[model samples]
Every structure is written in C-alpha cells, then in structure tokens.
Target: MIYNEISKVIDNKEIAENIFEAHLSSDNLSKIAKPGQFINILPSSSFDKTMRRPMSLSYQDSNSFKIIYKPIGDGTRIMRSWKEGDSADIIGPLGNAWEVSKNKEAILLGGGVGIAPILNLYNNIESTHPSHLFFGARKKEEHFIDHNPDKNIYISTDDGSAGIKGNLFEAMKSIFDINDFKDKSIYVCGPPMMMEAVRKFSVEHDIECHLALETIMACGIGICQGCTVEKCSDESSTDTYRNKYELVCMDGPIYKANEVKTCLL
Candidate 1:
C-alpha cells in the first residue's frame, strides 16, 4: 500500500563520513514495509525542489522505518539537515520485495549506499538461512558499518585500504568459486557497473540472480514516465522491436538479472 503521511523523524545521525541514517516513526508505513521497498520523501523545508527524493527502506520494525543515504545533491542535502521531531511528507512503501526459496543457498551482495536495502534482506533471511554479505566500499572509512553480530561479512575496497584489494565482484569471485554455485540464489544491489559485472557472472555460471536497480526518478510512482530500464522483449510476436522498456518505479527496483538488459558490459 502507498501512503502519503506526515512522519515524524525519531532519530537522525551520521553513521559514517557523509553517510546518514534517519529513523522515522510511522506506524502505518512501517507496518506494510518490506525489504527492497522505498519511500519518496518530500523535502518540506526545501520548497524550491518540487520532486520528492526516493530512499530505500534500510530497516523497519512495527513502529518505525529507517533510511540510510548520502547527501549528494540539493534534495538530499536538505534532508540531511532535517532534525529529529521534524515532520516530513512521505509516500511509500513503494516497489517490489525480494523473494527467496528455502531450498537454495543465498548470497547477499551490495556496494556503497546500495547496502542499505541489502541489510534489511540479510536481517530477514539470516536466522533460518545460510547467507553471507559481500560489502564493498571505496576506502576503509567508507565501510560504515558499526558492528555485525553475525560475522558473516566480507569487505572489499577500491583501494587496498580495506578487506580485499579490488572490487566486490573480484572479492566475490575469489571467495566463492563460480563453478561451485549451481543452485544458489544471489541477491545484489550496487552501482550499475558493479551490478552489470555481477549479472554477467551469474549468467555465465547459470546461477539464479536478482538485482535491486537504482535510477533517477521524479515520481516514486509511475506517473512521471521516468526511471525506465530496457528489458528484453518477452512477447512471441517478433515484429521488429528487440527490447521493451519498464519503469523502475512501477515494474521494479527489483528484477531478475536475466529479465533485464542490464549486463551488456
């Protein structure tokens, strides 16, 4: 269900350098919220910006939901300055959720701010399932996680300052052999380049892979005709169109790696 409500900010703090986490108290929004779903936050204070900024639900409970983000632009910068007890207009629990089968082993992959949603997925599946997180960052300080009780984490840095010397894809390839994962499921969220690499790797190995995609969205819903991703045509009628397009806001932020034309690189 989509909600447009005035939600009170319970807590807002910087967990890492330039990365902030905000906890908003909204019983209605949090109730139906799921991992991979997101909220469109309207910066009430910044009336100059007309569009809402879309943020993924990082953590959620019965009474509240959390979002982790970096203030990259004006919209998010305004959001960063917002203090606790401030009420903001928000529309969510938008987008699709991840679906996992109990029979297969799952691997959770995320890079940078993309790890926000992956964290939620890990929390839900870690208890009963065999899962691990391969997190990537540009440097050691950028690897912002305070603690991990599960200890099922693998870190990768672009520079050699952290866990693995290379990127997440390389770390993933080295840690787990592609040949060994025949029936495993991979849940990944990252930059498009990283996701493309993961998608290709999954395809080459014949592994079932799902991706949480990110794109520029003016509206969180499908009204704006924005955030379209190219997808391979599913129809049998072969007229001339080789590919179709889908809205990231409406059709997904979550899609099977095979279903979209994301990994051409």
Candidate 2:
C-alpha cells in the first residue's frame, strides 16, 4: 500500500447523526482513478483504530478526490475531529471500477450507504448511457441527497418519507413496467438483499447487470481472503466465488451482477 497524506479537508456537514463527509485531496491517486473504485482510510497512529476503513472516492476534479463517510466507531470519530493540517493514510484508486461499455442504456441501483460507489459509477456513465437510478433508504433523511442527480433519479423510503411508498425493488419494477424499457444493462450497489432483488429483476427482463458488492473486507487487497462470493453456475462448474474465497479489497468491491451469489444474505 502506497501511503498518502490528507492534503485538504473541506465542507463538514452532518447529513445524519453519525453520517458525515470528509473531502480530501490526493491528486496523484485521482488522476488514475476510474469509477467504482475506493480508497482505504487510516487515521493517525496515535489514534486508537488500527484497521483502515474503505470509503468510495466520491468526486474528483483535476487535482484531487473526496470521500463521503460516516463516523461510526472510535476511528472515524477521531478522524472527524481532525483539522485541515492533520494526516491520514490512503491506499487506493484500488480494485476494478465500473465498466461503461457500448450498451445504450443502463439502470443504476443503490441502497443506503451503498449509494457512494454507485453514484460515482453513474457519473461516469450517465451522459453516454441513458440511465435510471433507483435508491432505497431507511427514511427520507438517509436518501443521500448529495449524490442524487437531476436526470431520471428515483427514490423509495421505508417510512414513506420519500418518492415511492415502498421498497426500492418494488419502485424499480414499477418504473420499468410503466416506461417499457427493454434490453438495457444494469448496475447495482446496496444491501445484499437489494442486490439479490436486482439480480432477480435482471433475470426476469433479460437485462445485463453489474453489481458493486458491499461485503466486509479486512485487507482491501487479495491477502485476507475474508470476503468472498459464489460465482454463477448451474452445476458449480467454476470455482470463482466465495467457494475459493476471493478478497473484496483486491479482487472486487464491484462484480458482475450475475457473478456473485446472494443466498447467504
């Protein structure tokens, strides 16, 4: 892991009680980064946390990238209290980014905190591919208002505080059924249940889909072998997924929609 320092910290806001954003600059990393990739973040050595937390590269310009995160534990809590001059270690633009191929249209699905990577993926594909974004959140407050773009963005909240009356999957089905979209590609990132639902919908409609998996990762690289998923096969012919234990950090945080199994979740 190539260690880097946090150059700039700007715009601190509490979207929710624990949910916050830390925008940092690492120009070298951002120059080579693509969509669907993430950066592992580590607070100071004096801090209590030893493990690095992975956060998606939220936005980038010519010089740097940013991360949207939540202060969930002691580590993030310490990081959130840091000032502009403080230092943090980062290791990315790592793993495979979302592939925006020649497909004319694609559907982007996001749930809860899962929206981070999906938002970046959407920005990369939106202009070229006609796309629809369907997001599910706990309530209207958790909808991640920062990432929702103006074009074709749809939302659903469990408490009926947002766009639709029910879950994200149901809202997705309703949008597709009403609009008569066909033969499009799909990209999904969310809870495992939501990913499973997306897989089912894609199968039913014969839509090609990709998924950004949100499984736990210990090493953000191929070493730990902690995060794995079963590959798609009727007969278990291939040994690609959790069967062999692929690392989420190195191999993928984003995988082919049909490539990984969701049965465990």
Candidate 3:
C-alpha cells in the first residue's frame, strides 16, 4: 500500500447535480498506476468509516491525478472540503488491467458512475486503437462526453435530454450494432444489469466482449473479497474457471463480459 498527501485541488464543481470533478496532484501513486486500475481513499478521521472508498483513476500525468465523483456521505463531503494543498491518503493501482488484444476497432461502453474507469482506459488506449466511446445517463443534463467529440464519441440519454435519448446499449446499437463491428471487440463498465444487457447484445452480434466489474469494496486490495465476481465456461471467457469466484480487487474490477453472473439479470 502506498500513501500520499494532496499537492493541489484545481477544480471543484458540479459536473452534474451531485457529481463533481476534483483534480488533485499526487506524484506518489500516479507514477505507478495503470489505465483501468483504481485507488482506495481513506478519510482523515478513522472514526468516520471502517474502510477506504474506491474511486477510479480518471486521468493522470507525471505529477497529478484527476477523479470525477458524486458526493455520497461524510467521507465524500469531507473530500470536498480539501483545498489546493491538503493530504489525501490513497492505496493502489489495484486490480487486473485490460489486456490489449489483437483486435483493432474497440467499443468502450459505460454509464452513470461506472464510466470512471474507462475514462482513463480511453486516455491510455485511444492512441493504440480506433475507440468508439458510448456513454449514457438518465438525462441530457447528466451527459458528459468529455471535452472532445469525434466519430468515436456517441451519447444517449433516458429522458431525451441529449443524444439518442435511450440507454447506452441502445446508443451503441444506434451507431453500429454487433454486425457493424465485424470482428471488433467491446469493453464495458457499468451497473451490472446494464453490463448484462450489453453482454447479450455483444454475444448475439458475435463481437468479443470484456467488462470492468465494479462492486462495493471495503478493502480495495484482495483481503475483503467484497468485490468478488464469478466466472464461467463460455466462448467469450473460455479460460475462466466454471465454478470458482475471482476476487475483483486482485484479479479484476475489469473482467471478460461473458464471465459474470448478475443477480439482477
């Protein structure tokens, strides 16, 4: 576990109603983190919470890190109180990263808070492949397609506030469904039900699919098994153990799309 103090907090604003984007400088962890991994944040007071909260590594440079978050409690509220120079404790680049395969064109899908991990995935892999980013939210008011748009950036919303006015699976199909990508691969990160729907779509369309699994984690490292997800024998994740559980903290947070089993669907 690695620890550090905040060197700066550049922006603090409502990215959405309760959502915020906080840019902090942490030379310590940024140097070692990979694209699809995350960090565990510890509140200043141990009396507040028993464990650290997990947040994705949105973007980072040599001396800084940026995260987009929604205020959830005293912990997040306290994080908002941090100024330009303060201390923020962090642990890890914990989890299995997305392994770049032989595929060329890749579809990166995400929605709601699940979009965090893929933001950095895009930053790291966009240059290596032709990435089409499909994002969805409840309304156009919540749509954040980043600062740049391209043939790759597509958006949709549930309330018709923005792009396609539907969910991300629909947003993706609207552009080019499974048949469109031919042999293209897909990477997904989102609510479990949403991922399940995307997984079905990818399978029906004959596209390869991978998922970034996000679950409640008391310990962002392997100890707690709070983030464990199951694997199964399938065409998509052929190497997955049929009846075994994989710890999302150590083995994943990002998993092959077919390996997961969801309680919702």
The whole-model C-alpha lDDT of candidate 2 against the native structure comes to 0.70
Q: Which residue runs does candidate 2 get wrong by more than 4 Å?
A: 1-6, 144-150, 178-181, 233-243, 263-265
Model 1 misses residue 218 by how many Å? 1.1
User: Number of the top candidate by lDDT?
Assistant: 1
Compute each candidate's TM-score over C-alphas. Answer: 0.93, 0.86, 0.87
Better of 1 and 2 by TM-score: 1
**Taking the tens digit of each residue's C-alpha lDDT, what string does model 3 give over 1-265?**
4554544566556677666777877867787788788887774545368888788878888878888777778778877776666667776667777766666677888788777777788888887788888877888677667423556787778888777768888778777844577867888887777888887776666677888777777767677667667665454554644246777777777776666665132
The per-residue C-alpha lDDT of model 1 at residue 106 equals 83
Alpha-carbon shift of residue 114 in model 2 (angstroms):
1.0
In angstroms, give how far residue 83 of model 3 lies from its true place: 2.5
Candidate with more favorable, higher TM-score: 1 or 3: 1
> Tens-digit lDDT track for model 1 on 1-265?
6888888999888887788899888869888888998889886755577788988888989888888899999877877988989888889899999888688888888889999899999988888988878888888888876324257688888997878778888877877876667767899988889999988878777889999998888876788777888886767755443347788898888989888888432
Model 3, stretches more than 4 Å misplaced? 1-8, 146-150, 233-243, 263-265
Error of 2 at 216 (Å): 1.2
Q: Tell me the whole-model lDDT of each prediction, alpha carbons only.
A: 0.83, 0.70, 0.73
Better of 2 and 3 by TM-score: 3
Name the regions of candidate 1 deviating beyond 4 angstroms: 146-150, 238-243, 263-265
**Candidate 2 Cα deviation (angstroms), residue 162:** 1.7
